[model samples]
Target: MKIYIVGSVGSGKTTLARKVSAKLQVPHFETDNFVWTRHLKGDIRNEIEVRDQLLQDAIILDHWVIEGVHKDWTDPGLQVADQIIFLDFPSQKRVQRIVKRYIYQLLRIEKANYKPTFSMFLRMFKWNKYFEEQMKPEFIMKCNVYDHKLYRFQTDKEVKDWFHQIQRG
Candidate 1:
């Protein structure tokens, strides 16, 4: 099973992907690993070539769950996914989650996959706003193209219910 989870920052894409991966015993990949490279200075995005190659490798996995907010760069994975989960949580809820996660990461209580900085936190808020105002429409439009494979959830309760259904299946 190849699963792709897409949503705005803090929409629980990574959390759901991790849960699903554990439940299914499938490998999981985060787009952050592909998109950003660690350096002594800070985290930097990989070149387009490197990013694309990494994404290709993950998509070719026999069974995998990949999660990210990236859309255009993840088109290939979407095309190959058996299921595409769209976490459509409300903007207020997402922002709350983001703030909570950022604080945890800042305190070193939670391990961040990428460098955690105040600037990054601010950028996340900006991204969230952009997603709400612009990218969401695009995401909806693109998802329509894969309606058969799309499973969308707007609340944590709905996500839990869906996860239970998957477990039962």
Candidate 2:
């Protein structure tokens, strides 16, 4: 099974993807890995061609879960996904989660795959706002194209229930 999870930052896309990956014994791919290159200079985004190639490699897997906050760049995965999970958690809850996660990363309590910085923390809030104000409506509209494969959840409880149902099946 191939799954694609899309949502705003801190909407639990990564968390849900990890859980599904563990339960299904499938590899989980994060768009951040393809988008950002770790370097001493800074975290630089890969060229579009490079990012596309990396994403193509992951999605071609027999079974996998790919999760990200990216929309346009994720279209390939969306096209191929057997199931698309849209985490539609409230903005307030998402903001809270982002703050908590930022704190954990800052305190070194959580090991972040990417470098944690105050600027990045600030950007998270901006990104969240941008998502709510701009990207969300566009996303919803785009998702209609894949309505048959879409499974949207507005709460963590709903997400958990859906995950459990998938596990049972």
Top candidate on lDDT is: 2
TM, every model:
0.94, 0.95
What stretches of model 2 exceed 4 Å from their correct place?
none
**Tens digit of lDDT per residue, candidate 2, span 1-169?**
9999999998998888999999999999999989988777678989999999999999999999999988787899999999999999999999999999999998999778877888889999999999999999999999999999999999878998989998997
CA lDDT scores, all candidates in order:
0.91, 0.92
lDDT (tens digit, per residue) of candidate 1 on 1-169: 8989999999998888889999999999999889888776778989999999999988988999999988798899999999898999999999999999999998999888777888999999999999999999999999898999999999889889989988887
- Candidate 1 residue 107 C-alpha distance from true site, Å: 2.1
TM-score of 2: 0.95
* lDDT score, candidate 1: 0.91
Task: For candidate 1, give the lDDT of residue 38.
Answer: 74
